[model samples]
Target: MIPPATAPLFLEQAGWPHAAIVPLAGDASFRRYFRVIEGGRRAVLMDAPPPTEDPRPFIAIAEHLCQQGFAAPAILARDLNEGLVLIEDFGDLRLKEYLEDQPGEELAVYARAIDLLADLHQRPVADVPPYDRAVYLREAGLLTEWYAPATGLVVDAPAYVAAWEAVLPLVEQGSAPVVTVLRDYHAENIMLIDRPEAKGFNAHGLGLLDFQDALAGHPAYDLVSLLQDARRDVPAETEAAMLAHYKAVATPGADFDAAYAILGAQRNAKIIGIFTRLWKRDGKARYLSYMPRMWGLLERDLAHPALAPVADWFAANIPADKRHDALVAFAPE
Candidate 1:
């Protein structure tokens, strides 16, 4: 939390005369945010902890996307030295909440979301940093670190390492045209707003949020992140239709279902590690409730014939029945 004395300094700097600051909800990071409203116009204020959270990427990406004609939160002002920023608030109706009342129209809503994603993926990949192998391995490695300790099972780290190593050649060979992949482009990060001012069905489609972490990554990665969302149960048929929609827009090329499965397996493995870490390291056990759903997604992804080696390694090393128990221990009761 910023001291009351310091709040005046930021308000003065941003030129929002006599700004009244109110705390906004935050996620699992050290960063803090507040909603600042004055004279009926609203904006969000970010209080990022320097040395832990960097504001440069958010600034750079916001500017780049704004130039490229995407709907990103507009940057109103910034004090980089103090890690403070004022941004246009995209409003508060998350897609997760929107889908709840209108469950029957979920697929239609997702189709529109996919259209936006296709537009993002069509952009040149070179404009952003590569979502390289080192980061991939490091994310996957957390599985052994967190899951093993939480479960009290000594994971065969070497076998796990080898499994991921074997996956690399396949990933490289299966690489599709790169794009500015929204690293966490699932339902939670999307906001649904009324399109009172626009003239189309998708006018109120979505408001992108928490996209500061966006980076260049495989096109298939975000698709899996959306279709195979661990928190919500997306039907197999709906998943197939969305995949078809994406493939239709993509340049003529080999169908990348195999690569998609591989990436999903990789992603799910990393998420299990994250859920475990959240429970054990941060003591935020509420996330543990989602572990079974995550594992279920991982198993479904691994079921694809293309990921045989990765699936086989998991089957041979990790006992099926015990997995859920280990995951729940770290979850809040």
Candidate 2:
């Protein structure tokens, strides 16, 4: 629900006092979104209450994307003091939902999505925080901190950091030019839009959402996020084709295959911990359903020889049999 103080302020800023407000699905953050309709016009009100959530990064990223000719929501009005922004509504057809409804078109849609990435990567990195070793270690640490405790296991934090230190350098070897890595660039955050005549590789056919956490990082990080998605399964063939397409278009010298695997392992590890935290700390048990799929992806990434140290850490700590959902194991029977 929108905060009592925020509702009046949002309506005043948006000039939609009588607009019927309908709550939309929210994300993993403290933000709430509402669809505002008045006189047949529609817009989205993003209620990101301050101290816990801020709208500045979202506004900056949206403007940067728009400047690059991409399809990000336009900010119509905003009250940053109250953490409310009125922005363009892209309607209800998310790529994940659309793919579920039309499985046959998954390849075409994903191809376009890859094309969008290719276009974005070709541009210079936007001004955002670097997704470096420190970030990797901090994010991957969530596994040991949250997932370990939620299960009946103890982790050596110093050793965990040491293992990651040995493994993360592989991602930087033969690195490509850093691009604006939309940290959560996956199917769920992508929207399907109608723009048949949009030109070039960075066509605006796909509407971007949930990019407030973007960073200046290796291009492969976002690729792994897209292919080895936690919330949905992308077909292996599609992943292969997209990877090949990206390699063909991207600048040379980067070992994309190895980087993909290394970063894939890193990302999956962080997600496993994030999902566990969501369940144990936030009481969002639904996230636990994705663990099996995440484990499968993590296992695939660990198969790469570059991830031997981190993989060994996982094998020693989280045995294969114990990699199942913690929520189910710890549930009161």
Top-scoring candidate (lDDT):
2
Over 1-333, each residue of candidate 1 has an lDDT whose tens digit, in order, gives 553356568877777887778887667666788888788777888877688888878878777766666666778888887788888787777777778888888888888778878877776553567777877788888888888777767778888877778775555654467678777878887777556642121343676767677767778888888998867778889899999998887741354887788888888889889878877777778888878888888888889887787788888877887575556764545
Q: Compare the candidates by TM-score and give the number of the best one.
A: 2
Estimated TM-score for each candidate? 0.91, 0.94
Question: So what's the TM-score on candidate 2?
Answer: 0.94
Q: Would you give me the overall lDDT of model 1?
A: 0.76
Backbone clash total for model 2 is 0
- The lDDT per prediction is 0.76, 0.83
Q: For model 2, what is the alpha-carbon lDDT of residue 220?
A: 88
**Tens digits of per-residue lDDT for model 2 on 1-333?**
654366765776568878777888677888988888889788888988898999999999998998898988888889888888988888788899999999999888888888888889888678999888889999988888888887778767787788889977767664577789998999899987685532211455789999999998788888898989898989999899888887887763467687889889889989989988877877777788888889889899898888888788888887766786545654433
Backbone N/Cα/C clashes per model: 0, 0
